[model samples]
Target: MSETYLIDRATVLTMDGATGATPVERSIRVHDGEIVAVAGALDPQPDDVVLSGRDRLVVPGYVNAHTHSWEALFRARLDNLPLEHWMLLSYPVLGLAPLSPDLIRLRSQLVAIESLRNGVTTLVDDVLEIPGQTEDQLAAVFEAYRDSGIRANISGHVMDRPFADHFPFLADALDADLRRQLDAVTVVRGDEYLDYARGSAQRYADYAGGRLRFMLGPSAPQRCSPDLLAGIDEIAATYDLEFHIHVLETRTQAVTGAEFYGKTMVEYLDALGVLNERVTMAHGIWVTDSDVEVLADRRASVSHNPISNLKLGSGIAPWRKYLDAGVNLGIGTDGMSSSDTARMSEAVKAAALLHKVTGPDYRQWPTAQEVLTAGTLGGARSARLGDTVGSVEVGKRADLVFYDMNSLAFTPRNKPELHLVYSENGSSIDTVMVDGRIVVRDGRVTSVDERAVLDELQARGPELRRWQDELETLNRALLPAFDRQYASVMARQVAVDRYSGRGECWLN
Candidate 1:
């Protein structure tokens, strides 16, 4: 493997190290999968692969901070459903997915290709354990990430409670026979789950030359027992791993937490000593100002999924307040079933615009630059890669996106930041690189058989559709009772309400 170098005189946006916010005309040099220098000019070797920067703007690759890429194949299977219904009723098909290792690899590859083509270099897959999680299943997940050539933090989710028990009053709402049927939930022992977490962290931590990091996923407070959360926290502390857990993504979770623990789920986790610097709370929509402070004080981060939030009718997260409170904010496409796309630019645009509905203060709205930072550096913090790949700078890994200025969206080119977050979709991206490797160029995936993967999925789409139909039929019988219970909870008030129009406003 000889050295490779690239020199370009294009405008460069180095979203790096607390400075270099503006895009400047500069030249860049790369050697051995890392950036060696970024300056006005570079003398390249005769054999180096030199790329012209005449029509390109080189920027740091984005960190798609949170996702469940395994479910990428099941996009749009369940849509327009609330989080509770989606999780308990429709999305249960994920746990019992009848996929072989080969299918998993192809699905993950497709997800990687989509993300890479859209200028995302790192994906933090907060992956769930498929039912009867064998070593083979676990290894398949990591191997797919490795072979895909994208940086990832593959957190293995651990949950002890059944789907029926994730919310309070759920079991009570069902008949005895129905409740008994739901009680036969798969339970992986605490010790066993912890062992898997540890093994995965060790096995994949240094794999692919440290392009992968492993984290612990305790699921949510209601999804996992207290003991399990504690055990996970201990392992995370011992191994210095991050905790990627979903919290308060929906109003029902907020209501259920107050009823169960007499506190918010964030408050409960804080009491359990599980909230810390390494914890990245996903979809932190239903949090209060004090909750924001708590997270900020702990040095914790939040992965905001605006598209999924809007799709599920989850309320807008307090992004302005979170930023004001010094909380690191990250952007995500969530899972394919939730947002139905792995394109980070969609989430970036949504994050920039979704907060304007809450009040009349324009200053409180998230700016394109702020949201861009969230999509880049802040997202890297969520993945525990704050120092590595989120920025374009000397001594960092050469993970980059080259946006073509020739795109129609940027033809007039007023402000790059505004165009990036407001007007541009990913079509402006002409090239994408991860770990100094060109995975996407000319707006196409290069590292994998993209068409073959899509063709296989197209041919095999019915198997998943049939599973979805079966689950829909099974869940239709239970939605009436669940809806009633959910409505009852929504009518009542807690310490606070995060959902809009559900109750009285707390602000005067």
Candidate 2:
């Protein structure tokens, strides 16, 4: 049955695009799942649920613009590694193995719980573990999101190549059974990728009644061929869905793309007609000024994952460039394994501070308000849900977070917005509401058995770790053979270079 709730006497930070400039302290009345009123004159009805907002600040619930929730269970396992090595050493070890559906479901639940507890109501996660493992595994993830009382945009990861060419040792170490499973699977490309994305969207659209959305993630330019990318864009447009892809995450990727495609990665994608308003590019760490201009021209969005970039030693993203170019931007934690935490408030501060370090003048640094907007509204914009979910306002979904203003972090708060961005972390989130329902109250999640989820995560950690360790050891053992194979390839390349009279610079 539908219900009505009135949250009164709160200083609301209505991030509404129309009302962002002037937010007033008022009572918000939510009917069913949508906000019906935001005024002082409304009288409470007899059956309405009234929540007191004494000494609390109400703001829009955070939107985690991007994540890889499947990596949540693998946190802290690959710390202190460079970006290339992290992907080389950790991706296969953590992702390529045959994980039980139970483990995947548990990990998704843990990740969703972490997000909800921290005041994040929506997540657009890139779950690209293994191709064709999408059906039951993805359903399990959606079930976790539903049970956790969070909204999500989930997509299966698609890759078109065997690991041997990229991570030779990792490929060779895969058992015949695993190899057969991988090889026999049909690659998601062209119409296949489109069909999968559209089907998933329709299914989840029905499941959420439009609450839980689905997106088309093409993995990245390197992982996807041109035909697949074009098809993905077409599919998203046809279905009116959001499109996500990784771009310019590292210099190696950019250099490789330029060398292979005779154009920059962004330019290549632009030529393929994949850049548009509906597209959100994750990472974008190594984007050039021209690239930023192209994105701006296309009205595309950029997801700034400051912690993940720093953790992996990827260069800081050009936040100022994007802002100057008028590119819509948002904040993300990337993934638990890459970020080690799912705290969006910390991510907001990181975004502000990272720009301060890279920019020439501190005065030009991103402000707390700007960072907060990026985390909430910008993320909503990236997900194409800006009008509905990003802000606290009348006639919108009642997605909000309540922070205890009495906390030490917010003591004598001169600027509540500043305190939220720079001082208050997730611990200050006293209550969280999504779709007018209180999913978290008094810092405790109300939807799931928190202790049992924690216990399951703890119990499952060791087995996953053991499997990862075994895979790493096997990869190490096969490294010598891979080295020989690489040497052979290099020798052949050198011979071709010599015959062509291109000399040492030929490879470059």
Candidate 3:
């Protein structure tokens, strides 16, 4: 049993969701990894360990709704590429490389450390290509999460094709034999994928006492056939698990799907009976008003990755449309290769600014407090872990972060919540506790040897880069043929000026 701990003298932001309120100075009591009570000043029990929290803001740890930790090694490689080119050029290269279990574990550990330092206690890792890649290699990732002492919802990527048809360049770049190999690649059936995911989740759930959960991650409408999507939905229903899928990320995707299926991607998924409360779609940037209405009607959640969308030249998501339509909305850092950073506070600020610039009036924009709530509670809700870990309160897991108030950025703190969302960054986080355990203290990770991990990653990262570069060179060698094929396909498929009136396309 964990010992009782008393965290005193801090401004506690309960985030109970009843009101958009400020943090109250109070003491929090934790026992057996659960918050037992919170008061203005709780008396420490005989067995309680008292921790000083002077001049600090204590709030529930941030939840990262969408992420791909393996992409950390591919940082700075996909810069300046459009959405289609980036995926076509980068994903296949990274996916084909020989990443050892040690390297995979190391990369995941680095990502966990980055999140811990930023006060993110929970992560939803959207992992693909785990089956062909050895089980031991995948287990290494789980081990890293355990060692980091953070909760995770790990999903195995289930895709039938190596590259979807939406990626015309990559599709056209494949030679006849390579194309056959890509077509011959078979993913685990939805039932089989669920079995693997459940086994992994149960192992980690028992090991960490339910700190880890599994979700059904269908690799989007384009990558998945109708039968596969339906199978995934049925499996999720059978296991009572949450489901995640990438939806309507680019105009190209929407256009391609419309041309193929005579409906938008969201409509296609809906026809297959995949949209539901248990489903969360990442990057609904191309969603139409009717799509938003369907999502709201079905009570499905959407994760808005503002940084990633902007970085990939994907258009801005209709934040006001989702919010006004009563759709559940959350925030995510899509992946390291796309977003370049995993800082949630920065995401919050970007969300606010994105809305302000896109909306009809700046005065009616989402405030810092509202964006912070979306990052915290809304994100947890999207992951279906809201009741347990989203907020600070009695009967909830004691996943909390303590930020030092003495930072130069927060010197003249008029409003702690506002300053936290708007002015502060990860450096202000002095301590991070997940499930009542201090995973990070004094601005350093405690569960793993972070410096050693960084050293190993830095040493071995070049080899990974070499492998990636080799793949890129192979692809570049075939670029001329690919360019001609892409031109023909775009001329026949892509709809130019479809979004001509949708504001100045500030995303680019």
Candidate 4:
């Protein structure tokens, strides 16, 4: 049995759906990785560890609802590029550098520590699998999470469609050699991926004191074939797993869905019979009112990546519409390369402020409290861990973040939620505990050699970028063709527009 711990006199923001709205002073007790008692605690064990919670704001640990942790190695390296250029040009080059289990593990370790430092206790890693990587390489990822003392849910990203086919006019516009090159990109069968999923689920289902979970990840709606999407849904049902997929992220994607399926991707998923409660769609930026209704009707959740959406020039999500429609809204940081940071605080703040410009009506703006809920409980729902770790309750796991209320971010401390969402950017996060264990203290990780990890990465990152010249050569060769394709996609008017200045062209 583990020793009990007491967090005394904390200004606890329970983050529990039942009690998160109002912050209260209370003491919390934890034993065996679960929060046992939450208030009016009378007795204390002789061996118990009592921690002073004064000057601290104890909230539920932040959840990185959606992430591509493997991209941590290349974080911020491809900044200043939109999603189109990032995916089509910058990222594909990483495929040519090198593949090693050590690199994967190191990257995962780096991301896990970064999350903890930013007050995140859990991560939903939409791990973009490097093609032809062995199971051992994948195991290294899980091992790093376990060793880092952070909870993580991992899924190997599945994408069968060639990169050339992901766009509308790319194949037709590219030269024969470039077309052949893109078409020859790595491919894998749907069944093979499911087979791997089954084995992976069993292999690491209970790692890190039962903190690891494996899920099915379809890369996206248009990038995945119908057979693969349906097959993935079936496999999820058979195994009782959650599926994470990207949908309607960019305006161009809205066009792709209509051109590919004669409807929105949301409707296509519904028709394909895969739109259900177990699905978590990331970035529903261009979703129509009808699409929101469909998602709500299916009881699905959407991972709101506000910072990433803004950074990539993807339009703002109709979060107010989604809330009114009763769709579960979870906040996420997307990928390290996408947002260049995995800080939930930044995402929460962006969600609170970015939607204000959509209209002047103040009644529909996202509330700071709501964004806080999304960063906590809503994220748990997205990760399918709602029952276990989202909230601070008697039966829930003890995943708590200790923010310094004494910091400059909270100097006056008049409005905790408002200041948290609009001002703080994780500089106030002093310590974080996961599963009742003190994994982080005084802004340093307690369980891993973080400096050594940094050293290894610095030593190895240059080698991975050894093919920069070759990548530049290839990008130059394809940029013009890709530029044409981009223009064609952008010009192909869709039935809806989610951007601010690009409202529908009235033809009536």
Candidate 5:
């Protein structure tokens, strides 16, 4: 039995769907990792721990709907590059050695630490092992999440096609040697990955008492074969798991869809009967209005990654279209190297403000409350964990973030949601509790030795960089080929223009 907690007289934003538009003064009771009661007042029992919430604002903990946590070790290492070119170096098809199991555990812990510090209690990690997936490495990630006490939905990113398939003109643009190099790279069979997922699901089905869930992650539509995509969907159905995948993120991807399938990637998925409620598409940019309609009609969700999309020059997603079409929306930080942090506050702010540039209609701009809801409840729904987490109502998991209203971010606060979306950036977070466990108090993690973890990473920085450089060198050798491919794709006209400078052809 866990210790009962009584948070008394705090401003609570329940986010329970039935709550009012604004927060109200309420006390919450928690025991056995669940919220037992919420009301105007709660009397503490003799064995209960009473916490005064006089100057605190309690809200549902943020959720990072999409992220590549394994890239934490090399965060912000590559910048000013588009998704296509950037991933070549970060996710090289060849010559990159697999990270040691110990290092994988350490990196996963780092992601959890940063996420907790940022008030993100739940996150969906699309783990891409690059060269291949292994049981030992997967176990290391699971161990880190279990020990760190943060709820996480993890998946092995699966793609059964050669990396070169992403570029339609690869054969013409690349030299024979480079083409052969790509061909020589081994890709696991679709059935093999399915088997692995099944084995892992059975092994960790009830892991950490629902604190951890194994999900299906297809790398992306263009990077995967049709059969593999279907197979993944089938596996998801068999296991009753939510599946996450990347959709049209960039102009190049939109072009790939037209050239490969003679339709949009969203339509391709729909044709395959896989774009349903169980699917969560990351970075649904470079999509058409019809694509948005399909997503909404199918009851699928979109994990909007504004920060990463901007960083990668992937262009802004159809924020208004998604919302207006009734598409369930979620926000994410993307990856450590892309957004450089696991902070949900930053993502929430971006989601709240970035859509204003779409047009002069201020009415269409996202409100602070809307973005905050997307960052929490919308994310939980996208991950298929809506009924369990993402709210402060009774029967929901006790994932709560208490913000110090006395902090500078909340000084003279008029609207708590506005302050949170416009001013707070995780610094105002005083305590973060997940699953009725105090994982963070006074801005420090209680689960693991954070300082020791940082020290080990600092000591190993040089070695990791050296190993990364070796892989970069191999990938960089094909830069000229990729450069040509990128130019050729950009030169071709796509149906939709998602870039900010729509009229101008920047390639010239």
Candidate 6:
């Protein structure tokens, strides 16, 4: 017997295309963790909890298709570096001591709190457990999501191969002692990763009332050995799990593919039978036209992180090209280090405007409707949860957000979707419901003590900064090598250019 809730007289934007595009004043009836009805009038019953929705604009909650919740503590700490160098600082090839389970829970809880407050009800987090994963740490993360009242699908981000293999010229660039140190760094074996993944799936399959799920995170193809990739593909098939990996995030990565396999990363995955509908590639910035076709044919999705791409100096992805190819596109705020925040409104706004500069052809640009769909439904599809959430439909989960129309962002609102895409920055988010539970209201999360978590974060800041400073100092030795490789990759002629200002364009 699930609790019932009636949200009455709200202006709803059901992104469900089965329904019409018009925003209608409707009453939403939720029960049994699903929306039972959306009609013009749904009267409150004796057992129904009535929520006043007058002057509220209701829509499907945003789905963050790709993010790293583990890096919440490192938000805004890394800046002004390209993907290759920045990764070294963030992941630290030289391993640091692992974080305690309590700290992990605190960080994860903060991610959920911030996400719920910002109208994001679902998160696809590629959780990177530093130094390696442990059962206690995994449980801490799972417990945090379970307690926070937000829907989350997490992957234990894994990289089985050595550090030197992914880069194009790092092995040659490093000094002998540096090379020796890199070789000495221990990595989790492929078989161990597979075992852990299997065990984790079995352990957490029914966690958080099925709101918390697990996906396979290979980190990236280049970071995994061929056998490891094959093993992951096998595990995914056996368990029916979704796959998430970073692909061609930078020119350096593109060059690595050419240097390593004489093909693009997408082609490499396709060759290995890893490219399929179950896969979602993050930051596909430098894929070629053929690669786009391959992605479309495979029915794979791309989580476009425009803000992160811009911040990392990773080139803009071909948004128009991806759309034209009929590829499923989703928007993501990425991780804290690159995007600095988990606000999907900012990400959607960036996705809406970033492609206009791709060309002067105005018709090819994405509309407000397309971006909104990508932010909600497309992301849900990317996470393999399309049928469950992402829309305010009759049978979908009750993951909806209510925005105050009286807010300044919607003042004189001519077009609600346009204003949502352009003017609103999540400050208008008044109420957020996930799985039929009102977790956020009046700009605060109800599931957790946000003030205590924030205060704990501040209390632990000195230690975190000390660790971060030590990691930064240790990783600085490889900067010159990574810079050389980045320059080399940029100088080489790639098959396609995704950069906004890569070469000269002369008018005909």
Model 3, 322-364: lDDT tens digits are: 8889888888888888998777777777887877766467676
What ordering of candidates by TM-score runs from best to worst?
A: 5, 6, 4, 1, 3, 2
Candidate lDDT scores, in order, read 0.81, 0.76, 0.77, 0.82, 0.88, 0.88
lDDT tens digits by residue: candidate 1, 272-381: 99999889999988886778889999999999999989888887787777888999999999989889999999999988777776667888787777888899988988
TM-score (C-alpha) between model 1 and the true structure:
0.95
Worst 10 residues of 6 by lDDT: 499-508
> Who wins the lDDT comparison?
5
Q: Which stretches of candidate 6 lie over 4 Å from their true place?
A: 19-21, 501-508
At residue 131, candidate 5 shows an lDDT of 88
User: After superposition on all CA atoms, what RMSD does each candidate show versus the true structure?
Assistant: 2.2, 6.1, 3.2, 2.0, 1.8, 2.1
Instruction: Choose the strongest candidate by TM-score.
Output: 5
lDDT score, candidate 3: 0.77
lDDT of 6: 0.88
Candidate 4 has an lDDT of 0.82
Candidate 5, which segments miss by more than 4 Å at Cα?
A: 501-508
152 in model 4: Cα distance from truth in Å? Answer: 1.0
Select the stronger candidate by lDDT from 4 and 6: 6
Candidate 3 has what TM-score?
0.91
TM-score per candidate:
0.95, 0.88, 0.91, 0.96, 0.97, 0.97
Which 10 consecutive positions of candidate 1 have the poorest summed lDDT?
499-508
Per-residue lDDT, model 5, residue 445, is: 93
Estimate the overall C-alpha local distance difference test score of candidate 1. Answer: 0.81
